[model samples]
Target: MSKTFLKKRYGLLVLALTASGVALATVSQPDLPVAAAYKTERVVQELPMPKLTINANASSYWRDEEVRTGDTLALVLQRLGVSATSIQNFTKSSPIDLKTLELRAGQIVSARVDSVGDVTDIQFFRDDDNGERNLAAIERINGKWQLNTSNIDMETMPSLRSVVITSSSSGALSRAGVPVEIRTSLKEMFSEKFNLDELVEGDSVSLLYESLYFRGQEVATGDVLAAEVRTQGKTYRAYYFEHGDTGGNYYDENGNSLTRGFDGQPIENFKRISSPYGIRRHPVLGSIRMHTGIDYAAPIGTHILAPSDGVVTFSGWKGGYGNTVMLTHDNGVETLYGHMHAYVRGVNVGTRVKAGDVIGLVGSTGRSTGPHLHYEVRINGQHVNPATVALPTPKLSAADLAALKKYQQKTDETMAAVRGLPVMVAQRD
Candidate 1:
């Protein structure tokens, strides 16, 4: 054995070990993006099953059922699992008659069913033709129960409008593309104050009324918001306002209060009365009676206008006065007109009459000996001379003055903007 042979064997073993280590390192390195693209799919292990439990006692017992139109009470009872005897007893004891059970659509029925499939309680809720709901309840007690019924008032805000359509202005309004509904709404709104029948062909109307809308749909019109009327050469303005806690009357921009507290008087622009106001021999009565109101002899059928806006407290036949109309204005003022050919249609009790409205034609109706209108004015239920009664101007408070100034400025600006424009030529239809 020699030293040279031992060294050569040891060197060969070390080189072999080094070569094997390099080959192992190359195999252990991660693959590049391109090489990983073709890699084989790996199998995933299944997860363990989860435990779950549902308590039946905590579940809901009530069931909901939709009611269809033409469903009968017998059918409803059968659907609710109500026994025939129970239905008969319910029909007998029910406050609502059984024959009235013509079920409507979109109704809801709530029923409580026991474990044995017996109906414990049944509630029937259905909508009527007017879209009102009729609710009924039946409770099971010892295999027999009584029926209870009640009417539920649904809070609904319906839009309403009143329109006034006359051969005169209504036709023009219609031609202007104003809707018929609006016309009708306006008429209703001012029906109490103005009479559409009295409107002449050339007359014009200014409407102030409220329109109601429900969910964006126009439903109806409320009271008159405000209004103006121009017939012949006379103009009348009416305003709507609410009284405050201090019991003061409300007035509009034109300084006219909402009420005049009188009935029928010549509201048209008239000169001084021909006859004076005071107790004198009644020209028609032929007896010395107190002349309560001054006589203003205008043309025949010259619209007997309202001195102030108010309600028609009395309108109808008065024994000697012929066809008469009376209006109770705000603040304890009342006016009366007697001896008329005919009254404006729908000018009855509770009608809101406005200033300068033609209530009736001038023909002696009751005790009048001539075609002249016998007019009267009363204050606090006592007859007063209409000619000499000093009328008060509507006053403005500090806050109201400020508001008025602002409103006036805006109105002036609007008028200025339209000053140079062509006047809107309203064509009479």
Candidate 2:
């Protein structure tokens, strides 16, 4: 063979062997991990929880009612959602004398009944010199009936207001932001002493009174501490003085009692006068006849109060009068009440009652047309017009006069505080 051909073959074989060694070295090398692109960390926080409250004595249902004129203890309790058995249990277990409870009209009554229509608690409030200090409760404790009497801690604050009578007494007092009860009390205080109907447009009045607060809210208005009324260049002042046994009465600066001895109308706050005490056309008889007594038109079962202090002479069914009641007063005066639905319990013959006492319930059980009271006032067997009769005023005792003078000083201090204008917001609990 030729020497040049051999040299070219040898150079080709060396180049191919060098390329294979470089590829083997690249395939056998280990891989390295790449660095992460982001980092992370955890965070936590805590929050507070709220508190909850619950009332222990609250029942599933509650009811409230007002004492009616003909309401007995059982009737009132029944109206307040108390069961018949519950009422019997309460009356038997009660420690208070039910007979001594003067259940007057307009009294508030409250009851709490369970889901099964069973009364759980029944409560009634009464007032004294300390302002609603007595609480009568009839409740079920540990599945047994119980009656408890407790004293309520009331916060009493004095309030004052002065107003000029531009037109209406109630209106002017209302404009001055006086409460309805307070205005009523003020009117009643001076009703006998001064003629409210004779008040002119320019008359002025200043009043100092008390307000009862419970749980930061005003619950009731207390007695009128003092009042000053100016009419026709004359001023009349009344201050309330409390005397033990003699009772509380409003007395003037000279210690003269302002309350009248006799209430002319037999029914206080009557609806209207249906018939006068004169010759009038009979509604049922359809003829002109003499109406010996005044007729007070009112709703059924309305209260019939006594006109004066007297003893019950007769209480029973009478001809044309149905349930009739006769009272004998001082000086041979006789008052008769006719067509009564019912007579007051324990008010039989020889029962002595004071003025404003509930004697009977108005009804139309006899020969009548509707619910009304046939009130007759006879002086020596002669009927007189009750509307025109002049009532007498009683004189104050020496002890009452002496006590009133001392009370006047306290009223003066209260009036001085009242003159500051804009009754301060009562801070009470």
Candidate 3:
């Protein structure tokens, strides 16, 4: 964009914020009004006290604790106020192998502790015998500890969160309960627009995302639906729009597309691009052959995520690329993931997945010598170098603009829910 356009964009404040709409928020406060017609009266009644049971928890409440780095089973239980005896019983009685429990930071563990500091029940998830993570819980049943490992039906819901910038963006997002996956998307969206580290103290951040709940507890978080960051006297926002069974893209309120490139990276935290697209030298074959995909070197079991929303057209083994998965997307675009250790459970043919959703694990499975992920992008079945994909600022048609406005209606509803609690409080006036 030209300097003149940038100046005009920044000059437009709030109501005229963008071509789509202004990012709005209000603190959640419900007002209770007193009834003027009712007269006040005081009454007291005497009642007999019932007998209390000894050595029983009179007040049991739920407490949540997050697993941290270098934390052990005992440490987590101790932090949750579980007594030593109860912790010992929990370990010995858990259906899943407590000794083999691998603690990953950021996982929430919920426990019910009594007034005396004895744990009555605790809920957590861990890798099962088959290497699949499943929800498991230990509860006191008839004075004996029992374990239950069952898959609870998941419920999908929308989540909105906001925070005033006061230190680092990551810390602020974490304190606001934004999921790590959603945080990544938010950062990527604004990475090209501004530097988050340079944001001033009063600048605010807000986000809308998809949340998954299992048995009333949030099990996982999905894609970021929308996000806004107010900094340097201006508000920049992006909204995610799903194009039916095809895929979704991020756009400014004005309906122009906004993304780092044509699409996002398939997996984050890869060591390096072990091999780039195009033919040079074949490592295993020792012959110059066409290298059709980009190889991302990462440790085995590292998650492979979908670059965008799409439906799985293929999920199985193929010639040299072992355990491959292929997805078909809009605009005749398709993506392929090869050399996988294993596919994420339930991500089979015809399964619809969103960007950031795990599809497989990284590994060296086919015609290779070490662990790496082979990612390929195909348009109309023709191979395109992933590294050369460029960002396009295409013009929107009249119908397209109308559809974009219709999509804004959804975000407008989300904005209203947070309208009273403005994140950019200092600049609201």
- Please give the clash total of every predicted structure, in order: 41, 0, 10
What range of 10 consecutive residues in model 3 has the weakest lDDT sum?
Answer: 420-429
Q: Per-candidate RMSD vs. true structure?
A: 22.0, 21.8, 24.3
Backbone clashes in model 2, listed as residue pairs? none
- The Cα error of candidate 2 at residue 184, in Å, is 2.6
User: 186, model 3: CA deviation in Å?
Assistant: 1.5
Pairs that clash in candidate 3:
20-253, 25-418, 25-419, 25-421, 26-418, 26-419, 26-420, 26-421, 27-420, 27-421
Arrange candidates by TM-score, highest first: which order?
Answer: 3, 2, 1
The candidate that wins on lDDT is 3
Candidate 2 similarity to native, TM-score: 0.38
| Tens-digit per-residue lDDT, 1-429, candidate 2 | 468855665565567678776433222223346777887878787878878775545555656565667676668878866778777877777656776675545455667776545677666644321101244556678867666423333457766787667787667776675665456556655666676656778787778777654333343455567888888888888886654322245778998766554654577576577765543333453322335566778877888888788999999988677898999986456888898888889889999998889999989878777888887665544344343231334466887677778888877665655442433323221
lDDT by residue (tens digit), candidate 3, 287-329: 2234556778899999998877789999988756888998876
Highest TM-score scorer: 3
Instruction: Give the CA lDDT, 0 to 100, for residue 236 in model 2.
Output: 85
Provide the global lDDT of candidate 3 against the true structure: 0.67
My TM-score estimates for the predictions, one after another, are 0.29, 0.38, 0.54
Model 1, position 47: C-alpha lDDT score = 94
